[model samples]
Target: MLLAILLPFLSFMVRGKILTGIVCLILQITLIGWLPAAIWAVLSLNNARAERRNDKLIRAMKENGR
Candidate 1:
């Protein structure tokens, strides 16, 4: 979260979205676009977390024959 807020473009790169990271870097290059880029990074992080959690749950359910 800190990375997302402090360096929005870097966050995207860390997540392995090179194209998106580049776009974010471009957006973050301007002061006016910084806030939106940060918000986008944070939201993307949250969604990634949720997807991971859902994947874990699905795996557990499959193991239990559910």
Candidate 2:
């Protein structure tokens, strides 16, 4: 919720991808392009979440000696 509001800033903090955040911020500065920026932020966030989940699953498997 709050992430969606401060996405241009939080995107870098959460994803550690400064370029992506910067691009989104630039897009957002163009009022007509703000929607695309928001959509990109959401998609990027989702990708980051999936990557984290996959990493956790791999770590659990390794810990279990799988």
Candidate 3:
């Protein structure tokens, strides 16, 4: 998330998306895609956290079922 704030490109790179990160870096350098990149990073982080929470809930439910 910090990378999302400091370098939007690093966000994608940290996620193992080298190509996308490179592209984002180029776009960011252009000075026009910064806003979109920030928004995307926020949304991406939120979605990832939600998925992790849901996975934990599913695991708990299965454990309780047994």
Q: Candidate 3, which segments miss by more than 4 Å at Cα?
A: none
**Ten-residue segment with the worst summed lDDT in candidate 1?**
57-66
Error of 2 at 19 (Å): 2.5
Model 2 regions lying over 4 Å from their true place? 5-10
| Model 3 agreement with the true structure over 1-66: per-residue lDDT tens digits | 777877888998898878978887877876678878776766777888899999999999999999
| Of 2 and 3, the candidate ranking higher by TM-score | 3
lDDT of 1 by residue, 1-66 (tens): 999999999999999999999999999999999999999999999999999999999999999995
Each prediction's Cα lDDT score?
Answer: 0.98, 0.73, 0.82
Give per-model TM-scores: 0.97, 0.73, 0.81
List CA RMSD, all candidates: 0.9, 2.3, 1.5
Better of 1 and 3 by lDDT: 1
Global Cα lDDT for candidate 2? 0.73
Best by TM-score: 1
* Candidate 1 clash figure, as a count: 0
